[model samples]
Target: MAKQQLAVLITLLAFLGPAACQQQGLHICFNGWLKVPPLLSYLLCPPGSRTTNPPPSPSPNPAPPSGAGLSYDYYNNNGSSSYCPSAESLVKDAVKKAIDMDPGVGAGLIRLFFHDCFVRGCDASVLLNTTTSKDSPTDTEREGPPNKNSLRGFEVIDAAKAAIEATCPGTVSCADIVAFAARDASSLLSYGKINMKMPGGRLDGRVSFANETDQLPGPFSSLAQLQSSFREKGLSSDEMVTLSGAHSIGKAHCGFFSDRLPPNPSTMDYAFATELEVKCQGNEANMVHQDYQTAYVLDNKFYQNVRANKVLFDSDDVLKTVREVKQNAEYPEIWERKFEKAMENLGRIVDVKSRREGEIRETCWRVNGAGY
Candidate 1:
């Protein structure tokens, strides 16, 4: 019954769009209920059914995910047997050092975490022990079709892991380190404006399969296909659009978006497509920035690009057609704030109750030796 009601609510949300819902005074509670005014409460939350906690007031310091064993500073917990006081700071420092040498590395770090979580619940499965140099064929997430020869910034993770391990040996999990580095990278990339207190204490998983890469949405996904992919991951369509803002700092190989080349005058901008054709002509290896105007910044400019029909992917281009989402490009301070919340929700998708039960890999790549 509750499932049916939730399904019905989702259908309504799909029809109404988030902005329309907001205009109608419909509030989406984090608990998955639509918190409405007393007049509409019976229709939304229902009488005597599950109740949602009131939304938290916006604060510089937000609370961590509940029951996650995660905290703003889990490694430094004085009561813990293995305590590394500066665990997070070490990651931030490493991220800064790497980004200083190559600013593009910061975006790569963010993409790394996004890909990892989408594939295997943010367990660092994306960081499995497999590399281009290895001739020994291994079936790991790193070897997956979507990830092979694509994901970068592995050395950045390696540097952070080395720093954490040197300080506390076996205290921090590689998964937590990856999450922290991604958080630090985004903070640094956005000049500290987009900051979130990332939860710690996530454990590394021992299993990683190449086939699981299907969980990731492709560049060519239609609007419906993209929504369904995000839906499967417990994200809303609004959140999907919000997360797409990260593409402000992203790039894609030409081959990935070749179908749009020559441009479909309807969805994509013709002048932009012609320019890309010249830029990528005869070179499948060339990379195109998701937001050509500000390829290095993390902001809502990606939405503006979509509004101009200058985006690279069909998924990104479709965002502009949604009235609620297109508003993210104009007066989008609200969109930036929602981006942070959506990211927090993305990080929360992984269940952490069994974190202590999972192994802590000695290296970000390989699992720890026997009895970890």
Candidate 2:
């Protein structure tokens, strides 16, 4: 009887031990699997079952796709960096020659630069860099932002570049090209030096700004508003009036200032306001598009126009309110000196990186996706 009882006890121990081992083995196996969950599996699986290890996230995303319609490869593609000074002079001369042949860009490009610099020194920061902000529009085709009626300036630059390339290839930096273009372009009217300092290597901006539209002085703004806007950019009242030299080339659509008519009219010079009302026919469609002349000529005319109450924009005409009487023939003479000095000062604004502070974007309306 004792032997039989001992045998049964050993058999029972063997059966119970195997069953406990099996249960613990399953728990250990599950724990190991939980330690390495696959990415998608972790997301899809219930809280308890997913493995922890995600296959090394596919090597971080490759660079953004080109032809994304969002980027402009100004420096790396389409042209070389600025050439030697001899080459630069060639480029500058070439651009001048082309502008001599063409109607638009040379004058427009110079005027655009002057417009930007005069307000805040020669800091091309005024040019939009859409690369990071994602604020620029796309340019997959010719229908890009430059074609927009609002961004006519980009079209002007494009024309100038095409003209320059035709005459001087790979000889100049776009920055220098633009600077010279501005000087020569402005010189077209007055036959006088623009009194410009070449801030070479000003990389064109990657994008145009829709937001800046609101910030830019409009055809109509209260004197106070105009002063505030100009002041924000470190310009004074006289300087604000002087900067209107931009009007020398650009055309104003009649509709741009139609609101200044009778009933709800914003205050403007009587003679100037009356002429616009008559010419615009209270409809923007009737306004004329006028070509801009040289800065020296442009500045002198703006002062004279304001004096005559022939200013076009509301803000322009209102210049008389502050020191209208002070702006006589003497004002124009003084204006020329100040204007030239301002132009020189404007081109000197630079950035810490020394990368021209911006890029000369192929598409002015958009930025390169690589955040160029």
Candidate 3:
């Protein structure tokens, strides 16, 4: 293992230059890639090749996992079992292109992954489409109130699925594709700061119900409600706070937080609310970002935004009261490490599929045609 690590470090140095490596042995970690300790070269990935940008390498005393789950490694877990090794790359490329055109898509994919996993596990049941023919298509998760029009980036997922299907037809699951796309978005949005190696092997689920989306937490949810919802899913308060940091790249529809508008101090900053009122004036459907600082970057800035009462949702503002959550606002690195683990936990809420219940759907928006 030492030899292999040395070889990898040599390769990294060759690319990073000896001065950068020898002068600062730790330079490799912060050279705009996710950092690994002393010699975890395998974890080092190129910016274009990965989904999230990473910071400095792990400390001697690394923080513990946010919740129990598999170790992080985008390369090893991409096509779990070698089913389609290029699955991760394909999704990453597609997401990169889409996000390049519009950074907002990256945030949308992240939210999509959360909605898919929270309701019915990370089964991609949320991707199932509504009825088409006069046959009255059965209701799917897409129709749920939380999803309906709010969920964006379906086309991005479609493009990725098409790319994967062409190369390794019927091998990669739609569920995994959604996970991969979101994973890539993290890297791109963070500009290579968060590189989460997602564990694949998920199987696309056939079932989806509009009503099931109620399982998802709401923007108006109180802290107790948020804690209860996350706890039900095996996520801790710390993990909840870490995941909420995703707001750094996220936006909300006017209706989602309009209730907190001016003259109605709903724990929101009066000035921030007024600013939103102006932007949203006469446009009921306008969208707003919570992280006014770096709306497109994925980091801990949202915690700070929460501190200033500049956030859009009650769910976000309520977090400011938590001492630990507030602390995360002060230290970006501390929250980022936890974010990686929390994301892995969210993706693995359900185990890999079985032939009886799961299959690699040919497309993401619908189940396979005809009889099994």
Best by TM-score: 1
RMSD of 2: 24.5
Q: What does candidate 3's lDDT look like per residue over 48-79, in tens digits?
A: 22221222233322333232232334335544
Q: Give the TM-score of candidate 3.
A: 0.75
> 123 in model 2: Cα distance from truth in Å?
7.7
lDDT of 1 by residue, 25-51 (tens): 223311211223333433433322222
> For all candidates, what are the clash counts?
0, 22, 11
What are the Cα lDDT values of the candidates?
0.70, 0.45, 0.71
Which sequence of candidate numbers ranks them by TM-score, best first?
1, 3, 2
How do the candidates rank by lDDT, highest first?
3, 1, 2
Return the TM-score for each candidate structure. 0.77, 0.57, 0.75
Better of 2 and 3 by TM-score: 3
